[model samples]
Target: MGGTRVRTRYGRFGGALAAVVAVLATLAPVSPPAHAAPAPSVAPDPFFTYAGSTPLRELAPGTVLKTRTLPYRVAGVPLPLRVVQIVFRTTDQQGRAVAGVTSVIKPLTGTTSRVISYQSFYDSLDPEHGPSRAIAGSTAPGAMAAHVETVLMAAFLLRGYAIVMADTEGPTADFAAGPEYGRVTLDSIRAALRTPATGIAPAAKVGLVGYSGGAIATNWAAVLAPSYAPDVDRRLVGAAEGGVLVRPAANLRYVDGSRIWAGVIPMAVVGVARGFGIDLMPYLSDEGRRIYARLEKAPIIEVLGAYPGLTWADLTQPAYADPASIPAFVRTVNQLNLGTRPNPTVPMFIGQGTGGQLEGTRGDRPGLGKGDGVMLAGDVRSLARKYCAGGVDVVHREYPLSHFTSVPLWLPDAIAWLGARFAGRPAPDNCASIPAGNPLTPLAPAR
Candidate 1:
């Protein structure tokens, strides 16, 4: 609560405890170099469109198959730094080994033992909007959102940390598939550390940091590491995430009638359906199908705040009126739920924004704990405490501001927390001090 009050009142990017390098991110003007016009967008190669001969069935999940040089860019301009791309093996939710790519940004000078797998919150169902396009200077709306991470990535680079940006969505661009996100992230780390050109040592220390949609990937990666990617798990010192979506079912309920966030319903539905290979047409009402079709290829930036007061009732058939009643959605969302998963073995830094009402609410119901504009703060707190109970080192912070303000404010702490982990200092455990958060419960089946 003390930490919550501190962040609530003054959510500045660099607080009084600003590190030297973190402050450089704000002071040193970005220096992106000149580059030729972007390559013609010839139906840009889709992620996971692998042409390799080895059947995916025979390879391990972290095998790196291909490599290429990437132009490091911020906005439309490329940076005069070495950037390498690695396409490696990863798994889908059902355990199929698929391919994933990671962008490795080598610092202009110096080497660090730590590698930061910075996940961008590029929330989109379209392939063009994935991280690869952003690296190539695609100006698509969703692709532009990828620049949001470049600023932070620059901070990591300035600190001499080799940066790894994974296309966590996988070949199909499974936007909200939490398990796929985890698998892709862990494998990307594997590809980064093992590849000789990346300059990452065999035992390079790793940490994760993300917000919003990226937070989903970061959290899933942390939980999945111990069981699915034990090699990566042993290397991860800590992870920092803010405004995470721990419970998709609860998020759907929280955003159902929200004035601005309600727009997320259709996007999430379509993404989840694609992630699980489930055709939702039968379950959707006429209006629902139309909405889903429209947003099937839409990006979060283009659609945000566009549709207010949307609801499942407005989209789905009356028979499939209740979202939980739809068996496919219920099952898939349960798989995506982070609360039902194992605790991360490494230390965690989880932050929440508790000002949900900042954004308009069409007919918002109570019970979903105070959220940022989109995610529930109470749910984030619950996940943090659960981590504590499971004996993981946990650092939970809360802010009174809305989601937008919370993102920038939490970075200082995130950077500092991750730094502490890499420094081998013990993270302060809040297990005893943290009051009980919401119960870590799975979504119930429909009657």
Candidate 2:
């Protein structure tokens, strides 16, 4: 009976998803023949760099550095989308001023009074893989994820909501650096509202939405907005996210030896090392070094299933077998933990999934129980509960699905939740009934 119900829900969701894809198909240009020429260079555009003599620190966060209007294209096919791309000033994980890029897509007909800051889950270690590059027609291997996400953006755009797609990974493509993702997202909103030509009014209300890699940016942006960008915080109606990563340390453990998600271990190590400017070369084994070199610029798609049954022991020296033994890693993951951050002031809708076995991941792993293959369900529940305890309105839902399979189910509900926030409806909460999960304690250094 349970399986029957699950299938029924997915069957309905499939129909809805098909409708969305149909709309996207109509808007997008037909693909070229199989004999078409190879894709263009995937190099980062020169406009991403700030060449101005004025220092980045001198400019305010979200200060527009450059702007250009272009037709939005997906997978190298031009669509009728008039997108405004902006290079704005934002800070990195180290709080150093840096240039960030965002693409603003206005509805064809609307008041532009409401905006959806849609952070793309373009999880990559290469700057060339950002959404701006994909929207500008780059068909890089990593940019394919961004291209596919256009359907979600189209859903909101069809509802007459302006969409602000920021390169949440920042200019350096710091894959899992949560704080940096948050700041970049907040600054993107600032840049969008400040840019008159984008048609987003200064007083426009904003809502945050994303899943997976995007959830990292969305949740971080929500928590950091009150302090990092109070001006932007006041404009936020709510945040809706799913498959969130609450504690990086916990997630590393959760996916350490999984069949599909194990590769993320190395990719994350590389990302954190790059984001924090930490040199971990001395601690890596020869095998680890090789994996690092190969995945230095890989996208999440490339890493998924590429290294099956990979483990931390395979990547680190015997002495540093435990990730906590590495001081720099301990510090980095602790800093990236969303549980340590302040609760978002606005209402939030959080979704998580538990059924890793569906994705070839074992559910039993000591402290960690079931998860959606990558992100731990307990960690997400704990984070949501913490927010609720802090007097934040939070609606948390757990699904009996894997990370990838849960998206179709979570997205429609998330979109509907955001729609309610925009409609001035009262935000709901399941905080009181949420089950107890893991303790979000910080990682302790190895003695």
- What lDDT does candidate 1 reach at residue 228? 88
Candidate 2 residue spans exceeding 4 A from truth: 1-43
Relative to the true structure, candidate 1 reaches a TM of 0.88
Q: Across residues 313-400, which tens digit of lDDT does each residue of candidate 1 receive?
A: 9898888878878888888888887888888889999888877788764224566767787888777878888888889999888887
lDDT winner: 2
State each model's CA lDDT, in order: 0.78, 0.87
**For residues 1-447, could you state the per-residue lDDT of candidate 2 as single tens digits?**
976865565455445445546644554322333245645655567887889999999999999999999887766666655789999999999889999999998665535888999988889998888999888888676776665676765567766678999999999999899999999999999999988888777679999999999999999999999999999999999999999999999888888888889989999999999999999989999999998987887787677887779999999999999998999999889998888888899999999999888988888998888899998999898899999999999999999999988998899999999999999999999899999999999999999
**Model 1 alpha-carbon drift over 4 Å, by segment:** 1-42, 46-48, 361-364
- Residue 365 miss distance in model 1 (angstroms): 2.9
Q: What would the TM-scores of all predictions be?
A: 0.88, 0.91
